[model samples]
Target: MEMTTEILMSTMNTTGNGTIDGGNDVVTLLSQVSNILILVFLMISMGCTIELEDLKETFRHSAGFFVGMLCQFVLMPLIAFCLSLTFKLEGAGALSVLILACCPGGTLSNLFTYWTEGDVCLSVCMTSVSTAVAIGMMPLNLFIYSRVWTDDKAVIPYVNIATTLVSILIPVAFGVFLRWWKKEWTKYVTRFGVVLAFILIIVVWVLFFMLNPTWLFAGWQLWICAVLLPFLGYGFGYSLAILFRQPHFKCRAISFETGSQNVSLASTLIVVSFADSPLFLDMLFYPGLYAVFLYIDSFIVIMLMKGVMHLKKRRNSANDEDHDENKNDKIGLDNEGMATDQEDGVKVVAMKQIVADNSVKTDEEIKV
Candidate 1:
């Protein structure tokens, strides 16, 4: 719902004039264009992080890749749906949570994976695959699940989602070309993309909430879901990966992938589908809340992972030091044993010389 804010304003129009505002159309068009551009820029940056070798390696050990998809597409949506039921969320609340779950991993997941020193290649690849698959999977999930919560006959904005995904790939393909052809510039381009992506997110949110402060006033159940869902995702994702025996880096990447949803896309869908409906106001704000909580929770995971990695490093260093000390002690004991043997042999030789000299003296005296 790139144009959600404009839709929101128009929907909330209290003028009761029954006429559409001209200014809103301009705002909607601008927002839509800017959002698409931001996504393209971010996706391009994510694409640059992909390496030819990593792609080959991903195929070599494809278990982790499949696990990532399962966690993102299967487990996450299930978590969201279950949470909605458990919390007894009805109407727009249930729909909002479902939308978040159905969408693919966010572009920011790759960014967070990099920050956490995770498997960036796997993160990016999983995100790209999930997004491509979401063209079908997203609508399917909504179709199946939306019936559970309401009889509103939800509309899936498949065209908008498809257009967004296709546009995303165009920039990504270009970025990949840059990576392969102009390898020298890949580092700079990727860095620039990351920075720009962050700035865009901040700018978008600040502008959004600034204009609409009421979004921050959601119900406690929504807040609870927002906080609970991401944490559950991180925990389950990490545990599942460990059960599958994925390495630590891959686990972290998957955890972030599972937990950090593409909230921007979710918001876009809500805006596109429900903008003019009576339920628009109720559903529109939760995605922003989800974004806020996802970042906060994902950051906690990142810090915890970094701490564990540090402790592991320290323990390994301590073990190496202890091993070196034991080796040195063994070498010293061997040297001492060799030196004692040499000393004993020297004493035995001296005693033999003394005995020979004494016998020679006695024989000379007897002859005289």
Candidate 2:
């Protein structure tokens, strides 16, 4: 939603009745600029992780991406629909949840994939393919899921979708080119991009809650649903990948891709779809919750991955140290055995010499 300059941006200055305050044009512009900057930087950071080889490696086994699409377009929308029904939610709440559920995997998933050491190329591809697919799937899922509660057939936010695709693909392309051209700079760009992406995600999170101040009081049901959808997506995607026996790294990538939705896209769709409704503001609530919770869970998952990696590293280091020490001890023992053998050889030589001298003395006595 931070990237949606048309509608989601309006939420930054939204009054109590869903109208964006016209007076804060400067703040809005700055927010818009920062959002774009964030998008470009993060996309580039993601691009550095991609290479022709990774792409070939990714597409070589198309199962992971295919499974990702199934999770994004199929499982997620169903989860949202089920959540809405399970919560007995109606009005904007149900619509927003379902709309969010239908969104493509967000770029942040790619970021998370990078952090988790998952298949970055696979992640980037999934984000691109899903966003493109959402042009059709968003409305289709909205039509299928929202039919129960609302009469509005969501018009695909063509501008938002187009802008999102261009914004994503171009920067990523540039990053990919930059990577190939100045290979040395890829690491620097990647590091900067990762840090920039992390900070911007936090910024967006704070901005959403700040803009929608009442969202904190929006109740636990909406909050729980926000937490549930992504995790369920994660679990379902991961399980599906394991069932298909995807590589471990690819599983993490697929899991992150499935769980993370383009809530920004969802917000854009909500604005286009519900802009005229009386409950427009209410409908906007769920996406914000989903965004924040999705990120919170992302932080948790990444930290856990880091922790596990750290433990493994330490274990390997200790094992290496122990092996080195054992090797040194063996070397010392071998050296001591060699020294002892040399000493024994010298003693035997002396004994033979003495015996020869004795024989010489006996022969001299016999001659006398």
Best by lDDT: 2
Q: Name the TM-score of candidate 2.
A: 0.83
Candidate 1: clashing pairs of residues: 1-268, 1-269
Q: Give me the displacement of residue 105 in model 1, in angstroms.
A: 0.8
lDDT of 2 by residue, 169-214 (tens): 9998998888888889999999998787667666755555445566
Report the CA-based lDDT of candidate 2 relative to the real structure.
Answer: 0.81
- The lDDT for every candidate, in the order shown, is 0.77, 0.81
For model 1, residues 154-229, the per-residue Cα lDDT tens digits are: 5666665666567666777788788899888988987887787677666665555544456678888999999998
| Range of the 10 consecutive residues with the lowest summed lDDT in candidate 2 | 1-10
